[model samples]
Each structure stands twice: as C-alpha cells, then as structure tokens.
Target: MGRSKDVLIYIDRRNCDFFQNISDKFQVIFGLNNFWLAKFFIKTKYILFVLVNIISFYNNNENGLVNAVVAIFFATVYLVKFCQKCEIMEKMYEKGYNLFNENLILCRLNRGLFFVLLVLFCGMGSALICLNGLTFFVCTHMLLAFCIVLIICAEYFYACTPRPKGKSKVKLLFQKIQKKIEKIISPEPVPDSC
Candidate 1:
C-alpha cells in the first residue's frame, strides 16, 4: 500500500468523470472557499479528538466528576465537528450548492464560520476557567487548537477580502502578458485565395 502500484483503483472511469463533472461545474466555489472550509473542519476535529483523549487519560488523579464533564464536553464538541465536516464536504461537491447560482450561500457560510469562531472563543474561555484541571499536555493541546483555529480563520478571512470595482493592476498586467504570449504562440494566418 505504500507504493503507488500496490494501490487498487476502485473507481472506474465513468464514476470518476461524474464527480469530475461536478468539480468542473462548481470550479469557482471549489477554487475558493470550499477547500478552506473542509480544511478548517478537519483540522478542528483533529484537535478536538486529541483533547478528548488527553482529558480521559490524564484526569485519573483528578475528581471523577470533573473528568467526566470534560470528557463529555469534548465528546459533544467532536460529534458536532464530525457532522460539520460531513456537511461542508457534502455541499462542496454537490451541484445543488452552487455559490454562483445562489450568491448568498457563500455569505451564509461566512456567517456560520464567524459563529463557529464565537463558539471557539467560548471554549477558550471555559478552558482558561478550568485551569485547575490543566496538565501540560492538556493545556498544550487546547492551546494548539486555539492557535491553529486562529491562524486558519485569519487566512480564510483574508482570502475573502473584497476587491475594488474594475480590473485591478495585477489582473491587467496578467492579461497583457497573456495576450503577448498568445500572439507569440500563434502562427501567422495564411492569405485567403480568391
């Protein structure tokens, strides 16, 4: 399985093209936020899973009630996370979720993620409040989660920065370069015979 040749190809050409067709149809959305949305959910879930394991393993010396509460809280968190991951991945590929056709979809997604940031803020507050139960590993994992989410959120928001009206200088420069390249690449047209 480590080698490319050792892997089996389960998807036939037909099924593969069908999905590729969806990708081509929503190329714009996929090119933009869908991928970042998927990344955020998957990364956040990874951290949540780690935190859950750490809480269960390291809290043996602590009060059982506190341990259970922390474990349950993390469990609920990851459960929601898994669902969110599935939802975003599902919508990302589905033709029904075209961002261009339904312009507000992206707007709604932004709003939803902003709400997720708020929820994470609340979790950070709770984690800080429960510093009594903190272990080096536990605190590190939670802080890692906070930092990872913060950085991804920053990048994702930065990606959504609004452009000013009309073609920007960078775009115009690219178009000029493209036109010159095309001119050089094309053969001269032959004179039409009467």
Candidate 2:
C-alpha cells in the first residue's frame, strides 16, 4: 500500500534472453507484480518442448541414457521456472506493484513454491538414481516425461484460458497508477459558475 523506495530485485540466471526482454517491457507497462509468469510458460513451452525433445533424442542412449535425459529435462525445467518468475516479478512491479498488498504477493509466492517443488522432484529423482543405481532409473524417466506433459499443459492453459483474476490484477494496477499520476499533476478541479 505504501510506496517503497528500496527493494532488492532477484533474477534467476537460468532465464532465457528473449523472456528477459519481454518481462522488462511488461514491467514498464504494468509494474513487477502484475507480470504473469504462467502466461510466459504457456507462450514458450512448445518451443522449449521441441528443443528438449531434440536434445533428448540425440542424447538418448540405451546404456543408462535415461539419467542424462532426466538431467537435461530437469535443467530445462529449472530454466523455464526462472524465466517465468522473472516475468511475474516484473509484471508485479509494473501493474500489480503493491508492496503492502497481501493477496497478489501471496499468489506470486505460491508460484515460487511450485517451482521449488519441481526442482525438489527433479533432484530427488536424479539423486535416487545416483545413489540407488539402476533400480530407480526407469521410474525417473517416467517422471521426467510426466513433467514435460505438465509443462505443455501449463503452456496451453495460459494461452487459451481466460483468467479474470489475473487480467484484473494487471488492468486495475494500470488504472490505479495512471489515476494517481494524473491526480498528482492536476490536484484541483475547476468549478463552472452560471
């Protein structure tokens, strides 16, 4: 609610270059909090899916290649998650920029938690194989493929779905800031006398 003068911004190193640019532009328009990360995921997932599949296909091997495939998938997911986070944060600052707002902030935090879960699962699956040998390898690949599906679904939903709440966050924030700036510049209203 209150204007924040100092805030530390965090960026994930795994973010794609193009995504970074888009997020920056979005922030300029909306603010950081208003940025929607899932929408970006929906936008980029297909391209990412194709690239990941190509990499996995080439890297696919019969001699315990599943581990490598899973590793690559895990890494890619990490990158996507980071890019999404950056975009959402930027949007928040631009459109949903409320340092004192609780609901919107919690939503972003929920997103961060989901990313953490994805990473944990990736880590767990990978570590299980490294520690337990071939026993868990096949299972890990199954999980990796499942994660890929989830990514695709997310992308599709973001592209097609009408999320009124999300839309409002961006729209209302923009209106709020615009009115505030106008008020600041022109505080007094003129009265007409007949």
Q: lDDT scores for all predictions?
A: 0.48, 0.48
Shift of residue 149 alpha carbon in model 1, Å: 1.8
TM-score of 1: 0.32
- Candidate 2, residues 24-135: lDDT per residue as tens digits? 4555555442235444554365455445455555555563356556755666676567566545554554474543234333434444454556676667667777775554
Tens digits of per-residue lDDT for model 1, 17-104: 4433443343333343334443454456556655655655565555745765676576567546645644554455353443432332
- Candidate 2 TM-score, true structure as reference: 0.28
Off by over 4 Å in 2: 1-22, 26-37, 43-104, 132-194
Candidate 1 lDDT score relative to the true structure = 0.48
Candidate 1 weakest ten by summed lDDT: 156-165
Instruction: Report per-prediction Cα RMSD to one decimal.
Output: 17.5, 15.9
